[model samples]
Target chain A: MATHGKKQDNRSPADWWLFVLGFVLFAAVGFWATPAILYAEKPQPFQFSHKLHMEQVGEGCQSCHAFREDGSYTGIPSLEKCKECHGEEPMGETPEEKVFSKDYVAKNKPIPWQVYSKQPPCVFFSHAAHVANAGLECASCHGDHGDTEKLRTYEYNRLTGYSRDIWGWSLIPLDGPPKRMKMDDCAKCHRDNGVRDACFVCHK
Target chain B: MSSSASEMRFGMVIDVDKCTGCGACSVACMSENNVGVLPDETDKIRSITWLRVYQIDNGQPYPNTQIAFFPRPCQHCAGSQGHHTPCVSVCPATATDRDPKTGIVSQIPTRCIGCRYCVAACPYHARYFNWYDVPWPEGMDKPLSPFVAPRMRGVVEKCTFCFHRYQRAQNKAFTSGEAMGEMDYQTACTEACPSGAITFGDLNNPEHKVHELKKSPYAFRLLERLHTDTAVYYVSAREWVRRQADNYLSGEKLAKVQAGGGH
Candidate 1:
């Protein structure tokens, strides 16, 4: 019994140091390095200032993001819509406009805008209900993405490879707008508005 | 054909006599729901079709034999009274559900854990498991219906009766200040049926066509003796077709007349 106890407790001070060091290293890697590796920043197709366009157009978000008579949301304006104003030449003298005209508009190619607010394949979010029926402003869930001067580098989760909008911006999600786009966020909003529904209500 | 109430039980009544064995309904359903078919889909069991046409025949020799096409969609079984649908009750993840209000069985692919318990529990063989990610051909994704999100691999999917169409109809009615009726909301399969074999409407509403059709003497459900209480009904004039609906005892008499006399 004594020999067994001795063998069991035979870890030295150096061994103890190594064990503690290994544990700390594992913890640090798990808490920080792993998350750092998992998230990546991707560039958008072109930077179009929503604030500038909103101010110039004076028609609100609907001018760009149209809602059809059938209550279907036409997401991300087509190049034809862009050509309405930028028909002859590029609208503005900015690099973005030059790229839009020379690379896309002049060539008659559609801008492949990387959708930031794109949910997962399973979620079914109806823009008509949130926009027309519920009367929510563009700033509600999207935060101030529309007002920014430049588009933020889209952060993607390497595991799911989904836009951060699906999981949220922070490593540790907190309570607030734009913190996360998980089901809980939707449920919270629905609960606040006294909307109770089954799981299939938003998921499909 | 008024605005649908919570008590509304939307169901389908397909006239087996009218179906011409054409696969229009299945094709339409696949495209409408973005149900992708694999390249090597020769294995009918592995292939996923929200609405599949099964060719069943009367087990007889030569000239006496006749085959009929049975278009099988998810029955959206009401089950006994209202709850305990075979698929719904056996689902470990609760991915599939029978909506208490509309009686439409809804399958949420996102919530599905791919356990496939619902697939096994379903007697109709309506549920299909996605063996691979949606194999959309080049540029085919562009034309995919924006309303229905394409499902990923490792999930189970089944018919939702085009519930999104109902949602759109409701939205249109709300916008136009009108009441959405049965005519405004129809499944893609129902609309695409060339023979008009499939009829869909609120079964609870007496004014609806399905309410009248389901009460026909010829109308019978598949495996009704087990009492799945499936919402989908089939009507046929043939006695053999009705006999083929469910199993019977060795000497059990199903109908008053024997099998060979139908015209």
Candidate 2:
């Protein structure tokens, strides 16, 4: 009975540190594997520098991403808008511009640029309400995309087909838009702004 | 300027007398909402119809027979003062909600868990559960409206009063820095009615035709005694047609109670 009590008292101090180390190792693997398995990256049609375009344009983002006469946001400028500046020749000496001029411009095919912040088909996001009516800056929701030198790799969730940026880069989302674009972020903004956060407002 | 919940109450005043039961409203609603047409549409139980027309008749013999059509969409029930809309309250997943801004009940099919609690809770039988995925025939999907997402199977769906049109109108108004006009947003059924039986607009706006139409002596909502406080109002000049709007005890007369009208 005394030997048994001693054995119970000196059981290698329960190896509590080893248990914590095991937990940390598993958590590290989870953090690394979650993003790797869930997301698939695809390159944009061609790397385009928004910084260079921003320097050339007068009205900032609106110069290219303008709203239609009927108030609908023209998401990506069509080939016609690009044609207005660059005729049949390459505007810049960059290899990306040369490829754009030869493949998209010369061929008259629309560049299939993958949108990074594309919401699901169920969402009805109104740029008119947010930008025109509320007078919100473009940088409020979309980070420094307009001032970036090159387009970043577009990563999308395999299961939901949503952009990885929608869930944000971190496993645990601790920030709002410009980092995360979840429904909670939208609702938080709406709640803060005294706007109606009805389901039909955003969900058609 | 954006309208608030108290400022706008979008409702419909449908004139039952003028309706010819042509089913044009139903067809337009189906097409506008992208409601799926099953292969065997004759199977009424399986069909998904956002707006359904019901034929009611005065219980009279052949010579005295009179028939009228009631184009029934979702009542968009405002419920009572507490806003306990039957479907909205019973929706466990909050898949359905009555939008305070417009008094329009919205059903988010994606959020719906297919519990069918809302379907059962709705007194109007307006909600329908999609049993099958819509099989769009060759090239038929090309014309599908991009505004409203087509609902998948296992989700309860009902009439939205063509909310997408309202969104578009609001977008136009926001861009132009003006208020949404009375005619800016009209449901497809309202526009498609051959006899102009359906009138839709902000019931709160005096300038809108629906506001005046809803105040007519003949205006009565279906199952009014239930106190659903529905947005849709019906008008019929015929006494028997008005009587059919709600159930009454044998001795109770609609005319006697209607005299104390308070809708």
Candidate 3:
């Protein structure tokens, strides 16, 4: 009823029920939006300055992850590969290096550095296609790891094996358009670029 | 000037009649291809043997028994009148390709991710996988042929029809401006045989030894009904040794093959 016409005084019971339903929907979304922690995401073991490594140190990604002659990639540097440069312990001259050497590599045990960039074999993620072909920057998927000295830990859901903050999109990327890697985002990119997008090409 | 344009199909002829099952072919093939050995070769099922020499029993008693050694390799089939050979059709990567020029099946290990699909597809059991990283005692790597690349930990490898020899032949042909004639590329097993039991050349090439040998009265292919159109053909004067090549339902397959090579 219009107020200018002055037709009706009381609203219907159905309108009140509808109001309740809308309120309930809103509350449920807010609740789901709350951050759910997976594995207690923590800072990396030690602060690694990629800026010092890349721009100042003049080292590249291939320095750590070596490529095979057959075009397949293998991450993680071998102990012997590292000893080639640091045999006399040149890098370990610093306090941080001393700590890394004393705790991790001195005893022949390799560092179990956690990598967020790694994906499962079931999901085919090729750095070659993305970086070499599409001309995408490293910062696109990795976010801003170069700027930051220390790696931060976020809670990861064990069952799903994804970060809890990303799962709900509350703690991380709260203000961004769509948080977490969704299939639709990939589909949109593929559709824009006129690629075959065959299931076996990526999925298999 | 046009050497093999008359007829060209690369093939092999094995004389089981002369074969003593001496296992020289197996040793020669392994040494030539750089096939690795396992400590536990006791389990022949899982072990990698590109050329497995089977010792067939005649099932006779009272000194009437006979035995023969049959050395098998990658069939390099032309298919049934050029249909689908089992291993070639199933490979997803398109790594292996049948040479249209020579009719030889080639193995591309660099492309193989050790999926092991081709391993199961072969009924003759030709393909092998590198389960462990290849290791040499101390000084053996230098002796390996530079033409044959040592395979890494993860991949499938098979007989290459001694492709290095073909490359050498082609190199010679290119330099001399002469064609790569038949018998120019022979397998190591063929050359290593003391009794000259093995013949290697193109089956399609009429001038080649293999082509003429394939038309022999006793010439027959392994698993002909399966229709691999295998480049490797066997000649046996005996009936029972011929029967051992493939599975037959009574007189069905034998009758067909016998009719042709029977004379």
What TM-score is obtained for chain B in each of the predicted models?
Answer: 0.93, 0.95, 0.91
lDDT of 1 by residue, B1-263 (tens): 13245487888889999999899999999999998979778988899999999999998998999999899999888788454888888888777778876888999887889999999999899999999876788898998887788988999999999988977876676555576677988999999999999999988878889988888778888877776878888889987888888888767787633222111
Each model's Cα RMSD: 4.5, 2.4, 12.8
Q: Top model by DockQ, which number? A: 2
Q: Give the C-alpha lDDT of model 3.
A: 0.66
**Candidate 1: docking tier:** acceptable
Pairing residues by index, what is the TM-score of model 2?
Answer: 0.94
Candidate 2, B122: how far from true, in Å? 1.2
Interface RMSD of each: 3.0, 0.9, 14.2
Over the true interface, candidate 3 deviates by an RMSD, in Å, of: 14.2
Residue lDDT tens for model 2, B1-263: 54433557898999999999999999999889888788889998778888999999998999999999999999998888665999988888888888877889999999999999888888789999998888989999988988999998888899999999998898899899887888989999999999999999988878989888888888888988888998898998898999998888898978765622336
lDDT of 1 by residue, A43-96 (tens): 888887888987878588878888778767788888898888886487678988
Q: Ten residues in a row with the worst lDDT in model 1 chain B?
A: B254-263
- List the candidate numbers ranked by DockQ, top first: 2, 1, 3
- Best-matching candidate per TM-score: 2
Report the Cα lDDT for residue A189, model 2: 89
DockQ of 1: 0.31
